[model samples]
Target: MRPVRVRTVAAAVAGLALLSGCGSAGGLESTGEAPSAVGPARLWPDLPPASAAPYDYGEGETARIPGITVPGDDVHRLDPVTVAQAGLKARTKRDSGLDELPDATVRQIRDCRTAPGDCPVLTPYYFDLTGDGRDELVIGVRLPERQLAVRAYRADEGVLTRIMSTVDAVISVELAGRDLVLRAPSVISGYEYRTAWSWDDRQQAMLATRDEILRVPERRGERTAPTPTAPAPEGSRPAPSETPTA
Candidate 1:
């Protein structure tokens, strides 16, 4: 089989820091006086702490992929369609509730080899999200009603382990540094939701470290309608524009 081309985060990081100018230039130079540091103030300190978390973003939720093994510890050698199929199978075995993968999507995965054009499995991208100097497979699967499933897998001891998984009605997925940035439309007008998933070494999983709602510029001659978001299979509703919690 021909080698699959993969993009590396090491290269991306190197390119970004090539001219960062972090090193000293012969001597220490002070541009201006440093500003005074202001520590955070305690507000409502008498209030009792909440018993439970406000939201569950599925952090630290990871699983070892069944019926799949990495060949030569290379993630690129694995078939994207097969990986997606395994994920769907795993979802079915769990109590997914209303967040289950549609039957149509299951059929498409089986037909991907013969009907590549109609396959829901998108072209996979590789990145070193774990900072281990090895590329992990990043894939996106199209679901019904314009929703999408994004997942990432790593080769651990020759076994394929899924490190990150999430579903959303995504507008776009971007690789920013070592974080997987997801952009999705919000129900609120003139605003959009952004979530950034970063690798947590201590947790051994990707966590939603940053979530925000930002105002977007309206386009000319276009009416802004509320875009409804699909519920994630993990039983947590996607954050709306009003809630900026991670």
Candidate 2:
């Protein structure tokens, strides 16, 4: 016990002695080496890893940010993302996203199809998916969870209304003639799920005529009948010799 006490005191004293010469209270500390004892060498390092961009605040050199934008009116326009989000929320009956969006991200939906100027809405495809001569708007909306929503809209009397919407993950949508072909990735390695949608007059909507998980079997060839080899040429063929040929 006595030796242990002495050893503990000695260790404490040694630690204090070692730290005594470290530095004084005035020793300023910072990330970069002190420029002159008060501050760092430079507040920020040269930007752009390779080379610094020339910052000349001339007439147009200064960046001018436009005014605030928000989701606005839409008569014949639909953003794929916003529509997809709405579709997801409608289908799940739950908030698809949190309300914690940055002020910079808050945007008004603007009708980009008719209202000139540059709009944030993505371009939509037009096809008569409803069997009317007038083309209907078809859009593939990208959502979270790698989900996608294929929606079709029709504009009648200055009103754009969504008529059909289907959402799924890992999906690919295509227009085959008048039919809409939708394919989703299947768990099975070499197969996928496919659904062909065609507009039905009586149903007044797009209905899937074919829906099935199909295997796109790989094209492999097996030799059912081995290729025959040509017999040795008569002239090149060696004659059957009774004895060893000279």
Candidate 3:
């Protein structure tokens, strides 16, 4: 699997710095320093125009995994139903109300699978941050400044509400047994990335966050199972059966 790219928060801060500098220039105003002389206005030097590649966020070739070819030029350009199917393929089931989402929103969630798109996958397990019976779906998207867009979705009246959005580089998201676990590297201040996890309850949402840096390890759990008991030490005699009182 490709390493999930996390745009460190430091990168976003750097972008902000560049924009601030440009804004301070105030339309390229000149300082009091003397300006260099220019000859008569001749034809502008034939400098090559800036490349349009960066602006081309158009749909590209479809992504394929060995032995599995998703149908359509943009399987990434799918609707909620398709996304739900993908989740099923991943062995995850969708929350019942997920189908009620607007088609546009569902498509946006599906399209996330490719560059210039966002990938919203439904894991088999649920994360009940609020201790509510209903589990929340974890959605991932790319945001400005090389940051990630992480949100939690809960169904209400057939609509998926965005409980929250935060910065985070999601490394891997999966249904770990019965809980949803999102992993990302640690970020550094002024050179780090942001990552977060969130979930909604009947009344509110809860979120966990981290900042730039990497190689950190942690875990979170929602539901737990009963611990198995060890068998009685091989053939240890049970206390003599209680005798009935006369």
Taken over the whole model, the C-alpha lDDT of each candidate is 0.82, 0.55, 0.42
Best by lDDT: 1
Off by over 4 Å in 3: 1-129, 142-147, 174-182, 187-203, 209-246
User: What tens-digit string does per-residue lDDT give for candidate 2 at 105-137?
Assistant: 223223334443433334578787765567776
- lDDT tens digits, residues 1-246, model 3? 233334566677776776666646544345578978988884666876766555421111111112223333222323433434343223112232322334554465566556223444432223554445555555554434444444444443343443443444555654443334555544442232333333323324434433235534334563356999888885795766698667
RMSD of each: 18.7, 24.0, 25.3
Residue 102 local lDDT, model 2: 24
lDDT of residue 81 for candidate 2: 45
Q: CA shift at 134, candidate 3, in angstroms?
A: 2.2
Model 2 residue 34 distance off true place after TM-score fit, in angstroms: 99
lDDT of 3 at 120: 42
Which candidate wins on TM-score?
1
Superposed model 2: Cα runs more than 4 Å off: 1-122, 219-246
lDDT of 1 at 51: 100
Error of 1 at 24 (Å): 38
The digit string of per-residue lDDT tens for model 1 on 1-246 reads 223323466566675576455447643345688899999999999999899777665656777778998878899899888888787655422333433467888899888889999999999999999999899999988998899988888898898877788889999999999999999999997888999999998978788899999998867878667899876787575656995768
